[model samples]
Target: MGRWVCRLGPALLLALTAVLAIRPDWNEQLFLLGHQSARLLPAVFWRLVSVFGDWKTVIALLFPLAWQQPQRLPALLAGTALAILLALLLKGGFAVPRPPLVLPVGTVQLLDALPGNGSFPSGHAMASALLATAWSAHPKVGRWGAGSLAMVAGLVALSRLAIGVHWPLDVLAGALVGWGVMRLALRHAAPQGWPEEVAQRLLALLSAVLLLAVVFTAVKDWPRHHEEYWLRLVIGTGVALGGLLRFRR
Candidate 1:
């Protein structure tokens, strides 16, 4: 079963990517559903779920799981690193304007700013997918984890549209990238190791410190349009650093 999971992981990801990439219109409709769902769900509830759906949360959740299998830490780190690199590359390359910038649209009480670029791939979606993929190795937790991730991914993707930040295509592409990276990690996950209790404790501490720094930076730079960008960077960095620390003795 594990072997099959490793092999099928990439195939499933590729298939999902193709589906999302080719069916742009479908993504639009999906985005709309997400928007409506967001409206129906209470703001507090949505916000809570959104955290789980975010990439940083996913990585944090995976720390203990991956810590048990120190070998797997590398794959998770690689996946996270690639996701960050890809998100930056795509953001810079496309420079797609948000919906408000390109088309006049109603606001959705966004938690972040509208990036000054093209929205080809949803960074949030990609991060969520990558986290989901990394957790897919455990059959017991995989289903619930993936389902939770899907819910979060959908919300984040829709949040983008609700806030007029990204087109449906962009979210779809981001999801694809995230899923692909996760599969790569699963395929190469390492073997299990010692208890790693101390390692986990250290990682948790580091993650907390990094998170505080990010929050501090965001607060200090309040009202700036780049707050969301920096926030995500801080979160991504924390997750990556935490994963790396988990591997240390």
Candidate 2:
């Protein structure tokens, strides 16, 4: 996986870079096309898709999986940390402007509030891809399952563009870096940091924290993000409780 990802990286990066540089407005035109096309899907659909990009949603899905395969945590966590560090460093280095800042007002189809800058590569896109890749390694998943996860990762990355926050270049780069980093991490996964039992306890504690955060967010945002309100309340509680119950057993 690592070798394949590394081999694919340069070619993919070069192609995307060439496309972006072919014309001054090429990136902008692509962004506009993606943003406009998003209107074909219901706003609620886009919003729901974007929800998967949120950390809580990802965690809610991963914690139980990680519990079942504690050894996988080292690679998953390492990949997450590495990808985040790279994304943050690049964001600071490039300091690219977000679509909202560059595009005219009312151009972005916003699902929620957005930040003003540091948009070289999207953190959300990277995170979703990395997590989805880790998820595909579960023992029961088949080839089709892996493909579905890949599509989910792509959609998560694309949602950043559909909602008009990130440029197409940003999404493309993020998704690639995400999958690449996960592949590298999985191939070189460090020895498990904790005993399986200990890891379960720690994961449960972390899930408890995530549950609290979900509740806070649901309350803080109220009717404005009602879907998330119910989602957080339900999934957050369920995942956290599942982890806790598993720990108890």
Candidate 3:
């Protein structure tokens, strides 16, 4: 399983690069499909699906895995960090405008009211893929977990299109960024036995908090409001506290 994931990583990177180099019209076509699909599907359904790729939700899902298997923590951290860095670099370098900015007004329906940013290499897609790749690398998770995460990541990529914020190339590039980073980090996810128990306790507590946040978000209908940033901030604080606890000891 590990060997295969490692090999597939480079292939994905190359494929993304090739597609970008070709500069085909696939991006516009795929975006049109996403727009049409959203029109066909219930708005509520896609709203929920969008949350799965959100930063808070991704961290909520990732923290538990890291807590349960300490070895994965390093790779998860590194993969996510690398994903963010790469995503930012690509976004800035390309400076590509989002669909809403480039396409006809009212053609794109954005789920959120937030301001837009660079369009190349969808950040949400990259982050979700990073989490999925790191989680899949753990021996306890194996291929099934990886496959499930991949599906979730794919949904995330699609959600970007559905929301009309990103191009197909952006999502593809982000996915490649995530996959390649995780593969590199997997080589260094060794566990240090002494800190395992302490880190577990801290992370587990934070995970519980995130679970409660999920319930709160659902009850309050925050997804509909597109309050992803606030949710992410809360979870991010929890994660930081957990990190401090784990490292302080």
Candidate 4:
């Protein structure tokens, strides 16, 4: 499974790139299609699911998960960090306009203001894919667990479209970028005993910090008044607490 992803994921990325370059307008139709499909689901469901894709959620999950399985932590961080850097550079360089800007007014179902970022590759999609891929690869996880996480990741990507924030191409490219990077990075994720304890303890500390962040965000800051925001607060707080407890023992 991992072997196939390692090879084919990047190939699919390149293929998508070519398609975008050759028939740029093609994405418009796909975006419309994806957006339409997303609306078939309840808006509330997508709103909640979308929160799981946020980078804050990823951080909340990653540290504790790493404490559980120490070997993969380094490569997982490397892949995510690399994916973030690439997404930033590409988003800024391409400066692709978002769905709200491109489509006419009232064409999108906006949950929040489109502010402070160019749209191309969806950052939420990237983060979701990276974390999902990492979780799916966990040695302790079975096939069903892996498949479920992958499905959730797919929904998270779709939620970006449902909320009218991202184009189909943006989510697609972001998913590919993250999945491909993490899958390849796992080649170096083999376990090494004795030496990883320090890293594990640091991961525990990071988990505690993330727990505090979630708590503070949920309480002091005025909630963003959206379903996604509240959902993130609740889910993040829970996950952070769970991670902390796992490391504490």
Question: What would the per-residue lDDT of candidate 4 be over residues 1-249, giving only the tens digit for each residue?
Answer: 444444465576668766975776887777778777777778788778887778888867776567667777778677877888998999999999998898888878775556569787888888888888888777777666766776788788888888888887888888888887787777654435225767757666777787788877767656455667776777777876766676674
Off by over 4 Å in 3: 1-17, 189-194, 197-249
Please give each candidate's TM-score: 0.66, 0.85, 0.75, 0.85
Candidates by lDDT, descending order: 4, 2, 3, 1
lDDT of 3 by residue, 150-199 (tens): 77887888877887788888888887777777777777654343376655
Pairs that collide in candidate 4 are none
Better by lDDT, candidate 4 or 1: 4
Q: Among all windows of ten consecutive residues in candidate 3, which has the lowest summed lDDT?
A: 189-198
Over all chains combined, what TM-score does candidate 1 have? 0.66
lDDT of 1 by residue, 1-249 (tens): 444444564466467657766886675566555655566655545444445445555666667556555556667767888888898898889786655554336533554555565577778778766776666666566555656655566666566665545667777678778877777666764435324564465566656665665566556666654324454555556665765565445
Superposed Cα deviation of residue 168, candidate 2 (Å): 0.4
Name the runs in model 1 displaced over 4 angstroms. Answer: 1-37, 42-48, 53-55, 105-112, 142-145, 189-215, 218-249
Mark the regions of model 4 whose C-alpha exceeds 4 Å error after superposition: 1-14, 189-194, 219-223
Model 3: lDDT equals 0.70
Candidate 2's residue-wise lDDT over 160-212, tens digit each?
Answer: 88877888888777877877888888778774546877777778787778778
Q: What is the C-alpha RMSD of each candidate to the true structure, in Å?
A: 6.0, 3.2, 5.2, 2.8
